[model samples]
Target: MKMSEAFATTIAGVAPVILLVAAVEIGNRKEALREGYHLIGQRQRLIDELYAAPEAPTGLQLQAVAAQTDQPMQSATRDLFIALYVMSALIVGVLLLLAESLALVWLAGSQRGSHPLQAAFCLLALVIGFAWVMLAPMLGLVVAVADDAVVVISGVSRLRRFYRDLDTHDRQQQAADGEQT
Candidate 1:
């Protein structure tokens, strides 16, 4: 078979998978954005509560703030979801571009009936696909690690602020109660 025909066949086989991967990546990004917004809303609500109370909230109000904070903290825990989506989109684009380049090379290399080169092209395509599959988990791991680091830093900051606010609120409450008594 001619190299052009083989290259076309290879592309035909690979394009669907590339497109599918891209689609999945886009979906993940959308989900991440959705969750991010949800967390942002929760955080905003906490800020609202902190502002709305006439005096420092006590007991149940404090508990409510703590409960609301949990959702944002939990949602922010993973950085990988966003990173994976970006990486997957990038990988898919690279793969598609590489496939086109390979097809061009195959067309240029073909001279008369050269089935061996076509076989080699097919093998390379398989190898590339397999390599991507193997590399995906590693990419995910990198994203997850980076995300964890950010979460740790942010969580600490948030906790510090929370504790400070709670302490101040407790002091104010004690003063108010003493005055009332």
Candidate 2:
């Protein structure tokens, strides 16, 4: 078979696996985002409880907050997300191994001794091709599933900001109370 024909056939054979892995990764991201939103809602509720009274919350509210924080991470939903990440990572690893083997075979069969520069160029091209194929699909899947978390993956920073704002407000209130007294 011609070189181009072989390349086309090999890619055709691999495309389905790559597509399937990408779909799984996208689904994982979606579910993870859903779970994250649920956890954030729980956290917001806890925060509301803490701010409900003029005085500090009692031990019961603190226990409820701790439970809410731990529930999401400890649940089966998180296990499924972790499993998807592992499976997708394994699929990507297999694809990389296959690409590396193909590159090695192509290098061995081609007349590399005759033109060292051409051989080097071919190796570089193979690396670039592997990177494109390996990363592009995953990147596209990530972008598609990003939703509101496109700029911030974990969203921990947003929570931190909220907490900081609350602290500042509380400090100001304390200062006002002291001044009034």
Candidate 3:
């Protein structure tokens, strides 16, 4: 293969590796988000318990409760999102490199005499360009979808836990009432 062809092929190989990295990264991120979301939800529940009594907690007590409950959740969210952002950036970098390399090959071939093969190379370059252009926006959309999904999943999970706790409390209260009667 010609130098340009060889370089383009190498670049093409890189594209797949980049895609694999992106997939793995996204999957890892999703798992982390799920774990973090559940953990934070658990913390929020603990804080809610502090407010369960008829008497309101004092301001100092509330502040202490917030400090204890919010730290781990905040840490988890920050770490997960940072990882996602970095991986998404890597996906964009690889896509751009692949497209540019192909475009370079097309440019080199055009400098020589035009042939039927040139059209094929040109088409390949166009496709690469389109893919590169689309990758960033598509990744953004994926991240947005994932974010919304995590939020909804966590909310529903928290609600389920809340209702279950409420049911248990009610049952216990009824049992005590029956014993007294």
Model 1 residue 177 distance off true place after TM-score fit, in angstroms: 41
lDDT of 3 by residue, 1-181 (tens): 2335555555455555555554665665566566667777778787888889889898988888778776565456454664566565565655555565654565556464333453355445445545644564466566657766777898898999999999999999999999999
Error of 3 at 11 (Å): 1.4
lDDT for each candidate structure: 0.66, 0.57, 0.62
> By TM-score, how accurate is candidate 1?
0.45
Runs of candidate 1 with Cα error greater than 4 angstroms are 1-8, 48-62, 101-181
What is the overall TM-score of model 3 with all chains considered together? Answer: 0.39
TM-score of 2: 0.37
Ranking by TM-score: 1, 3, 2
- Across 1-181, the per-residue lDDT of candidate 1 in tens digits comes to 3455656566656756765665665675676667776777878888786879789777887777888786576556454455555665676556665665666565556453555665465556555655655565466567667767777998899999999999999999999999999
In the range 89-126, model 2's lDDT, one tens digit per residue, is 56555554455455455545654334444334434444
Instruction: Please give the lDDT score for candidate 1.
Output: 0.66
Ranking by lDDT: 1, 3, 2
Identify the leading candidate in terms of TM-score. Answer: 1
Q: After superposing candidate 3, which stretches have Cα over 4 Å from the reference?
A: 1-3, 45-55, 59-64, 67-77, 80-181
Poorest stretch of ten by lDDT in candidate 1: 76-85
Error of 3 at 144 (Å): 24
Error of 1 at 117 (Å): 14
